[model samples]
Target: MTPAVAGASVQPDGALHAYARARLADGDGALGLAVASYRAALVQDPARVEIARRSYVQGLESGDRALALQSAALLDQVGMLPRDGTLLMIGEALTRKDWAGAETLVGRMVEEGNFAFIAPIVRSWIAIGEGRYAPPVIDSKDRFASLGLRYADEHIAFQALARRDLAAATPAIRRALAVRSSDGAALRLAFAGQLAAQGAKAEALMLLPVGSAGFASARVAIGKGKGLKAAGAAVTPAQGYARLLSRLAVDVGSDKAGGTLALRLARMATFADPAGAEPHILAARLLTLQGYAPGAITEAGKVPARSWYAPIAQAELIDALAAAGDEPAALMLARAQAAELGAEPERQVRLGRLLAEAKDFAGAAAAFRAAQAAYAPDQLPWTLLLFEGSALEQAKQWDEARAVLQRAAAMAPNEPLILNYLGYAQIERRENVEAALELLKKASALKPQDASITDSLGWAQFVTGNVEAAVPVLERAAAGAPTDITINEHLGDALWTAGRRYEARYAWAAASIYAEGDVAARLAAKSKEGLKPEYAAP
Candidate 1:
């Protein structure tokens, strides 16, 4: 493809050179350098709309607030500023406590009708900052009506707390929490911090859930009478509004509607409140999902180590580094985090999951074992045992894997997954065929809709010399999960055993579609030669 800036051949200038450099850096994934070059280009040719637009987006992606604001100003001057750009302008006014300027921008937002839902909220904050205590009125018909109302009330609560009006703040916070869908833990923690800061330590302590590792630092601080020093507490209208924007970002992200708008809101939130951790974490997650791993790492690395979200940010950073093709750095960071938070089983499990994703099965098994050791032998959870057994199995430690799986099965007798795993492993190892068949039968019964479990039961039937029954069961399994290579292969074996030679070849052909390596070779052989003599007659 020809470069858009290939116009460097036509009356070249410094701006053209810088624009070409920026485009190259952008294609090379050096987003920070791209933003810098774009900024330089814009500085050289302030009238270049193309340069301004490119710099505006790259600035947001690279977390360059100055560049974003500079480009945003140029765009606004030409009446080409996007809604989010206008938002950035409003946020800047709010940050500097320029109430009149913010009100003017809010008027612009209202006239544009692009961000109408949030315009009222921003205007309410501007009013509050200007000493007007009018309540926020949300239109019940707005698309984000619930969220708008919830966040407005939350801001009011924060504003009340700042005024030491606990009588009003408490109920507003309670109303916000009631409307919140996903546990509202962050709100509880932040509100608790504000309460502690207001000398209501007992009330603050009551807001936190007992025995949560993330709240340990906050709890200790409040206990020591030092007040909660966390960064997320909203002590002012602007910070409260930032928190609300961060929540809206998460809402948009959850819809899987693409990350561009979510990242915009997240970047705006981070700019509006530099000390807040949630916005940084949200921005990092969105960037990572969009395959901008370097940008993700930068966002995650912004969270202060003393904040409540530091551990979450560390995990995000490790994952981002791994995604960026720096596995060694990811491993080093994961190992350091696991060691530091070794007492927390959750962190160890996260490390184990990361190792598993990296295909370091033995390391994953070892991490899972560390997680197991965190619990008493008698108190071990079946889920942990299952994870350890699966990792060990993948690591080729079959003997230990079987033992751990057996323990898991005994602990969770009704769990279809545990039953299916143990039964399937026993069948593969050709040990205790009768017991394996019974286990598979129960698993198939427990989860009739599960194609894999049904496939295991049918395979067990074929191994037990029930060819007639196996053929139909395997057919059902194959029909349920038509794309499943293993199920189709198992169906082929059953059909071949039952003398349906032509249909068996068709089944093998279906299984061969996505097969790879040895499986592909074996499927090709099966389609041509049927089964081996001993297996041909079941």
Candidate 2:
């Protein structure tokens, strides 16, 4: 359109100079200008959902359903929004009786792990709706233990009543009671309007504890809902109370319990309000920490595109996918946000790394090219150049790789990682071995803890014909990185060349398991012969 003309368009200010000036046709409400301006900005960058978010919120407050829907779609497209929107969106979907849409929204969030905390509650509703009278979550206890509140408590109560096991329901009801202690009220509420919905009367008669107005409010809301609408409205205020109970449970639960609780809460948030990004983020992070890659991705998927948390959630998702060896999928997700994301160079670098990890060298090369283009005017540009060199070297483009690496080394001479790798490469090619040894020495001093650098330094010592000196250093490097195939093989080789035959055999034997390339095979064959034992530990 024109430019972002806010409410004060009389003269012309910051926004009017932007594309939103055309949207001024919406008239002069506080939200009108912002909506117009943001939409205008979106026209310039269709993938720019954050700007559309401003329009969406303003549209919602202005009661412009169409505009709100548009923005909401944008949020979905961009993948980040408040969790509160979960309740609002699903509630509206239910109001229109759009079962498919509701299912898609709710199910997507659950699958994405956004509603981890409230998952049990949502599952309870779904099960109940499907006529499963007593559907208690096996995971509920652990989750509730963390949040200090168990949605399963309600389910267990209902299940006990279904089985006529009032006694079994006692413990669960008791737990809910600890949330505020109202005896049979929580039990009764759990049994509302279903087949064998016991405890309903008891719940109606239940009152909140003497103190805690918020708790009382929530207790009443839960007691009042007969169907889903009332339940939906009831959830907003109740969540705060539940969250407070959750905080109480934070220390009360173990890490496993907390993880369970986080998952349930995320599910509940998604089922009830699909728009909340934090719950999804929380779920994704928890799952990631727990080493559940698929679960983490599912949780991250709950975020709306318009959220401020979108980038963080995306970054986490990408990391998880990469760690899980699903680099291709990770690249797809990250690339979509490349231009708009804050750490443009970082994201590009990450993408390049992922591509390399996947063995898609050409794709990695392309990624480095794009990343190089997006590099910020800072240290990152230099960093990207290093990454480009690495990628090129991996693809065996030695000439290009060498040129770039030389440039990188000169630009940031202090970076030990690059220096060690480049210097080691030069030694391997037998080109500039002396210079390579010098660089490797510096690298060793810089990162004494780095096994690779130590190995490189030791390798250089051996190459320079200092066999006796290489023995101890190579051995040390091998021990430090026991699992490293290269270090083991090198140590074994150094031992043999130094006439430490027996130790060489043992070293080579160990190396066989962890080593790669032709050396490992060669060592394996030699170790089979039971070479003489002249080697000492020195």
lDDT of 1 by residue, 1-538 (tens): 2454544453355887888889899988888789889988989888888889889998887888999999999998998898878788888899999999998888888788767677767776787888876667888987868656756777778878877788999988888777664636567777888888778888888877555565677777788866354432446666766877777777777777747788888888889988777778888888887778998998898887877667678878988998899988988888887786333676678789889888888889888888887678889889888898999888889999999999999999999999999998888777898999999999999999999999999999998889998998999999999989899989998988899999999998898899898888888878777798533322
The true-versus-predicted C-alpha distance at residue 503 of model 1, in Å, is 13
Error of 2 at 429 (Å): 1.0
Query: Could you tell me every candidate's TM-score relative to the true structure?
Result: 0.74, 0.48
What candidate 1 gets wrong by more than 4 Å, as runs, is 1-17, 44-48, 77-79, 110-114, 141-144, 174-188, 227-234, 332-345, 358-389, 397-538
Clashes of each: 0, 47
Candidate 2: deviation at residue 265, Å? 12
Per-residue accuracy of model 2 over 1-538 as CA lDDT, tens digit each: 3132334344343433333453443343334455566555555544545456665555543334455566667777656755544544654554454545655666765655545555555444444444455353445355434441444465454455445565775666566556544223322332332221343434433433322221333344445543323322222322322332233223223366566444433433343344544445555655566555665777677665543245666877887787667867788877765545233555666777777887877667777777666445464556677778888888988888889899888888988988997898888787898999999999989999888899999998887888898889999898898877778767877888888888887777777786666665566666775433322111
Q: Indicate which candidate wins on lDDT.
A: 1
lDDT per model vs. reference: 0.82, 0.59
lDDT of 2 at 226: 35
What is the lDDT for 376 in model 2? Answer: 55
**lDDT value, residue 102 of candidate 2:** 57
Q: Show the lowest summed lDDT stretch of 10 residues, model 2.
A: 232-241
